[model samples]
Target: MKSLGEVLIQRGPFSEIVIGNSAIVRAMLESGVKVVTSYPGSPTPEIAEAINSIPKDKNPLYFEFSTNEKVALELAFGAAVNGYTSCVFFKSVGMNVVADSFVQLSMMEIPGGMVIVTGDDPGANSSQNEQDNRHYARLSYTPIFEPKDAQEVYEMFKKAVEYSRKLRSPVVLRLTTHTAHFKQKVSFGVYEPSPTGEPLFDPNANGPYIPIAQNVPVMKRRALEKLLRWQEISENYAFLQGNGSDVGIITAGLPYLSLLDVLGESAKKVDILRLGMVYPLPRKAISEFLRKHKVVKILEELDNFIEEKVKAIAYEERIDVEIVGKTDIEDWIGEYTPEKVYSVMSKFSPELVRKVEKPVKFVRVVNRPPQLCPGCGHRPVFYVLSKLLREKDISVADIGCHTLGFLEPYKVGQILLSMGHSTGTASGLSMFNKDRKVVAFLGDSTFFHAGLPGIINAVFNKHNFTLVVMENGTTAMTGHQDHPGKAIKIRQILEAIGVKHIWEVDTYQQDKLEEILKTALETPEFNVVIAKHPCMLKFTRERRRKGIIKVPQMKVTNRCTLAGVCITKFACPSFQRADDGSIFVHEDLCIGDGSCMVVCPSGALEFEKIETGGGAK
Candidate 1:
């Protein structure tokens, strides 16, 4: 069977329909994107996945799963500077990491095109916060193209790249969760190869590369000039006209789709203006639309970016248009649905609007919230940490699979923040609160990404805390992308970073783990404990791929005592309890990592090799 990657890379005869994310890959391929890189994130992972899925020989683009968002943007920026079209993509919060370099990257002129995709999570669906990155485009002085669906994303991406080259600045492709995840029929287009060839760095081409104090104002002026030029040159614009209704609606991105869904036969009664190019405000186009309508309602998810601007345009242009947005009538938080849009529009057209009944399902099933996967190595670490933690001791957590410790039997992380926030915040807690001990937790990938600075903060300030570094060998949370900390042992990095006292222990070794943790708590100054273990799920798959025989399944023997220590204390998802309150191992779920065997108090769990391709005899 031909893989999705194979279909995406084809030079000709593309599929008739594709998902929103696949369309982005198709767009990249069509545009002859020389380099594609990203830090894996939800609603945007499929773009990189499609590229990585294609065989190296079949795929023309140089694709990389960068260590972090900042590195991904910088890598793509390097490619762009050397005259190769490049793309860097990440989720909403990921932009926070990239923003430092991105702000500076905006000031430079690029010979080759660059497109930065920001997959914003408006509803906080799979994210910690719902951030509006349209402000990033404004802050960076970059033009942004907001695509509504798969087809628009495909078409706008091509335009965005060209505009980036033309404007000599990176263009932001703003995608909400709905737009990126939404599946729709995208008509295929012929691949148009990028004009530039393989990039070769030129030592002599150093004029625009230097961003000294003197060039700061010069770059800012030039960026402003380009923005002014873009307002006129870019033709990828949209404005939906109604049948001369006094009440007009202005929206952009996915919210425009919501407006269309609710308009339903009453569309002719109102004017709708959907702006694809959100930044620069499309003042010329918007002013014209505002003059035609008596009253305009703005519908957008999260921030009222468009609403505020449209109101300003009305005041500046001296157009008599009453703009209503984000008031008691509608909502401003999370995502905008068709029903929400309908409720707002119904105010204008009361007779045309009718509430539609929504279907509800009442099924008797256990609530399955996301948790640590069966036999995850971090499970044991969290289990032990939860056991050892005192009421006075606080656990601070960074972004990773270990964040799951905030739930279930562990219930760690009293203070939760963004990536690398644990260490930074823990440093503050240790310094001010002398009565309590702080235990900050972060993964290997996060240590490299954002935890490094916080570690430094603690060391330099002489704050006392126990930093538990979970070295799971891969970026487990975001699909196990390779990182520097994983490549070079975290111990070496810790030593170099001035971490004098470091203890390394296998997470599965419960006795040693408990002892090491106890020592960490007892120590007065800064302490570090590295929980060294490969993610069990990934390890098992790797072993199977290498043709190694699977380990014997762990089972509950006749000596079973249903004390529930394995279930409550250890809390491995593989442990299941029968209706009679007897404990047993769900053999299919167990990876035979042997953590259960070590922790089982009654010696109930035992590992026995089964007959060839058969159950235990």
Candidate 2:
């Protein structure tokens, strides 16, 4: 079994099974991508992970996890303008952060070509919302591609890069959660290694990259012209499939694949047009297809992007096809599945509906609520906060693993909007609600991302609220990616920002943390508390990698009176109550941090040394 890195670098006309994200990287290497930048995000982080898997010495392209999506796009844009094929990727909502520059950049020409990959979450599976980024492509006048599976993800990416270079414009490659995670056997072509030599940079080669008022009209005209050319080229583009049939199905991305899965052999009964180049609509091809079919159903996820466009084309061309988009049977929300397609297709062609064999019932599954990791660093901080804070004390939560504080026994987080909004939201709350103490929780990764501005606002305004900056040493929520905090200290930033009341304490030191919280809450000024600790999962992994086997394991002593504080209030997943009504530590789950001892009022928790086969006790 070759590692992902080994598989990625393998050359020649061989085939390997890989996920869509990995396939995109293979496509990048084959397309001779010179630079890749991204902010770690779900359904797309694996793209960066796959690139990182390749050793830095052997890696063909330059890659970096930028501070945020906007920074990531700018880095890639710089490389693209300097005559190097570049790519930047992020999740659905990340498009919002990059939109400020994205819309503007589309107006300018990219000589080296650029591909903006957006891993759209149709179900909001791991995102804040299910945004259809195809709208961004339409708004920016950029060409876009939507691949059905991992195999198409590979081929379309290569085409996208080439098309971007030919058109002298950036292209958008959109993937939903289903397509991004979908795996298939993809045949590979020979790797095209990037040419040797530094790409020459000319600031004025494209002439006036800025989009000021004087240049706006010229840039807009150029963009419109490019869009028209793309529309013409798209008419001949080999994205649509299938032949003549009165009953037709027009779809793109994952929904197309689902339609096929539902129809199976019955698909031959209807003509299917799967649009790979989704933005421009391939107006001519679509109009011709509508003319051939008496009834057409537009199957798509999230929004009626394709459906509405096809209908508009029909309306303009005066085609008499009965076009059906989102109906009462199907919704525009969530990922489309074969079952869903079957349900919708039955409305049009009941005879074509094949009986789907339902899988037999196995063991009944129980609903388990999400909770913090067994030895999470945020657990101690949240535990202490829950113990100390009054009901009137409002705690605002930012994005990260710490956001889980809103669930279960802690219930520390009252409001959460987006990443790094906690401090700003808390400021607003503090101004109006003078009687309550507003404490905003922020993670280290978020502090560098967007929290700094909020903190600065707090200091300048002298808002009376305690801001707890949980320094867990990495972006724990998004797969432990490194941030600016690895080099620069958060406390130092606070001091430089003129936050006079700053207290730094270890998160595991409950006594010190509790004392600091008490003092910070009573200060009646802008108070910043830096609770510093590395994420336990990352810390333990590093320790194991270094061959350090002996670790302190906590045990439940007989003094535990079944008071249920550890189970009810603290709720570390490690502590379990047996059927016999006795409390004990599940060694498999326990990381032996012993932070639970502080919450055990009976002094029943104690640490004991344990050694594995690798080292001495």
Candidate 3:
């Protein structure tokens, strides 16, 4: 049968079939890795899918979509602990989520081979922060390997698993976005899938199956002692060997690739000490390599992890070789591209001099903050709240799509705090300030993530705040991930919260929404108002997929009062300010949700879904 590598390149929508991660997959399959598991995330998602796509019949390596990173880690750990080689993967920030299980395996120690793959997003591309996972390796006192490219990533996985089993300790394979996403040619090796049957077990007092209390300290000590052996393994290993030169560039991860891309393959004046093992650092090997060279440049990304350790070691050993990396180069959180590497290199040496050009004129596009998409269901609710605010009741809102309430025309929300804070915040002020008129606006997604705690606290205490949940049947933010409010009714949660006065509002019905608000403001009890509608941007998208959403026309009418309020707060992309400063829906962008109808106090905005030749979703 043809190899799997040949299958993907032939038919995958892959913009480029030649990438780093793809190469790594081919290598893992060749090496006979028996298990893989992870959650899907950018950059790292391919790793999990790569393993899963491996022909199950050809390779018995079981693959799964673990619910969360912890589940993936534990499942892989269980297999590896029993002596079956396994791989667990997750994004870098996920490390914090799964840190609880991280230190324990090292404390308990692994009998089989285990590799924890972490893909660090340095530039916050699709992450919460730029965290260095290598520190986790050092904190756990385990070895870590960093590969710079696809070829290295493939080779390192085999070495990492081998090292983990050989030392009876788990190893971390710290992958970065650059290394995980790039494309490069990788040499192919052939091997049919070979399954390592059930893992072997040794019945001993201090074996992996031992109780936590009796064996943890002993395991920790053994893990520390095993660190000493890593230096020998790293130096003697052919993959990480340092060549002869006065300056030895001790580097790891993609920054090593950047430096190589900068230097190119031609010139070989300086020996590059490409370090795959980053944690417990293989100190003996690095120290020996540095001592032999006149100077060492630690080319790495983000914090000077390796350089800092190397500098300290050099100081302790009284080695005269200077460790220059972060100290010599500017420190910033970004991937090390060839341009940056070349710029740094040219700063000190003239061999790789490149010309600089003057800055070119560039147009500055106005960055309007994201508001409700054209025809969004969330807007009509805001329009009703705006009418309420303009007429009688003043609303306090929470953090969400509704948070745009504070942005313009509506400014409905006076305050926004943790999840469903508007309800409690408004309630606190309403009770103390004795303001009987107030409503709190929050999104369906926010209501799920942290709304319960706030609502539960408020309802029990009999807080007099009207909580208005914009229940759009989906989490609009974070790309429409599932939410409890989506599966279960939002009213169910409110009923459980013990809210006394409850009513549902169809945001599409302007007159009814206004009438409900009029009654809600007068009664002023611990009330719950849920506005339900599918997001216009999202709903019409489904119709467009079925080739249904027709071109909508803007009906010219004199009935429009031209309420500037719609333009201000209910800032839908579909709604634009004309030369007359009148807000009109951008017909091309409108999805016919009929939300603009609620916003026009003067009945200006109207829906006219007229069929045109074609319209983009």
Best-fitting candidate, scored by lDDT: 2
Off by over 4 Å in 3: 1-41, 46-68, 82-86, 109-112, 165-168, 185-213, 236-248, 261-270, 328-330, 339-567, 577-588, 612-617
Error of 1 at 437 (Å): 1.5
**Model 1: CA > 4 A from native:** 192-206, 233-236, 328-330, 343-362, 541-552, 613-617
Q: State each model's CA lDDT, in order.
A: 0.82, 0.87, 0.68
1-617 per-residue lDDT for model 1 (tens digits): 67887777666755546677888888888887788888888878878777788787667788888778999999999898888889999999999989889888767877678999999997788899989998887787888899888899998998888778767678899998888888877777787544547665664563456778887887787788888877775334856666788888888888887776776777767888888888877887788788888888888888888888889888988998788887763376768778777776676567665564478788788977788877777877888878888877888887888888888778888878798898889888887776787898988988888888889878888889999999888877767677886467788888998988899999888889989998998788888999988887788878989996557778889898787888887788788889988888887788777887877778888887767756565
By summed lDDT, which 10 consecutive residues of candidate 1 come out lowest? 200-209
Error of 3 at 413 (Å): 9.5
lDDT of 2 at 567: 90
Task: Look at candidate 1 and tell me the lDDT of residue 171.
Answer: 88
Scored by TM-score, the top model is 2
Model 3, C-alpha of 456: deviation from truth (Å): 7.5
Which regions of candidate 2 fall more than 4 Å away from where they truly are? 203-205, 236-243, 328-330, 346-351, 355-358, 546-550, 608-616
Rank the candidate models, highest TM-score first.
2, 1, 3
Q: What TM-score goes with each of the models?
A: 0.93, 0.95, 0.72
For candidate 2, which ten residues in a row score worst on lDDT?
A: 236-245
lDDT of 3 by residue, 443-486 (tens): 87666644676678777787676777888776554344345554
